[model samples]
Target: MSRAGCSACVRAQEQLAQILADYDLRLAVVDVDQLAEQGDPLPRAEFGDRLPVIVLNGVEHGYWEVDEKRLRADLDALR
Candidate 1:
């Protein structure tokens, strides 16, 4: 998940882009504020304060930053 104008979110996305393809992974960037405006406030409520939340396989992996090392390990385990 992410929010508009969030620098951390941008950085996280960039980091993911660099590595996801190597692991055959895909990323879905959800804007928390947009969810709230659409009346589905769960994501914003659950993670509003933490912009740039990274979720892998429906499980939250990290927030504020992309932990590439740990994420790569998790992806490896999934295979």
Candidate 2:
């Protein structure tokens, strides 16, 4: 997730934790301003303007306010 101290990111993290309780998924919080500290070779401009981006299976899911019901159904289908 590309977050920058946004309140929406905090809320989304809480909601996602509840929804992903049974899944073996991991949530990595990537601070857009601190990527360089983590040795990320990519440039921040790629996601600078878009904070709270959710990545699922290495694909961009979307920004904040994820569809909980739809995501649950997708996870169920994955099973």
Candidate 3:
């Protein structure tokens, strides 16, 4: 989950983009603010405090930043 104008979120997305292709993974960026405007505020309510929440495989992997080393390890394990 993320929000507009979040520097951390932009950085996280850039970081993910750099590696996702290596693992044949696709990223889906969910804007919490957009969700709220669309009548679904659960994500924002649950993780509003965390601007750049990283969710991998439907489970939250981390927040604030993208732990590339850890994430790469997790992706390898998935294989």
User: Whole-model lDDT, candidate 3?
Assistant: 0.91
lDDT of 3 at 16: 91
Predicted candidate 3 versus true structure: per-residue lDDT over 1-79, tens digit per residue: 8899998999989889888989878778999999999999899998989879999889999999899999999999999
Candidate 3: list runs displaced more than 4 Å.
none
| TM-score of each model, paired residue for residue | 0.94, 0.75, 0.94
Per-residue lDDT over 1-79 for candidate 2, one digit per residue giving the tens place of the 0 to 100 score: 6556688888888877777876876567777668756777363666666667766777776776777887778778888
User: Model 1 misses residue 69 by how many Å?
Assistant: 0.8
Model 2 alpha-carbon drift over 4 Å, by segment: 39-43
When summed lDDT is taken over every stretch of 10 residues in candidate 1, the lowest stretch is: 18-27
Local distance difference test, each candidate? 0.91, 0.72, 0.91
User: Model 2: C-alpha RMSD to truth?
Assistant: 2.2
Question: In model 1, where do residues sit more than 4 Å from their true spots?
Answer: none
Model 3, TM vs. native:
0.94
Q: What C-alpha lDDT, on a 0 to 100 scale, does residue 26 get in candidate 2? A: 56
Error of 1 at 75 (Å): 0.4
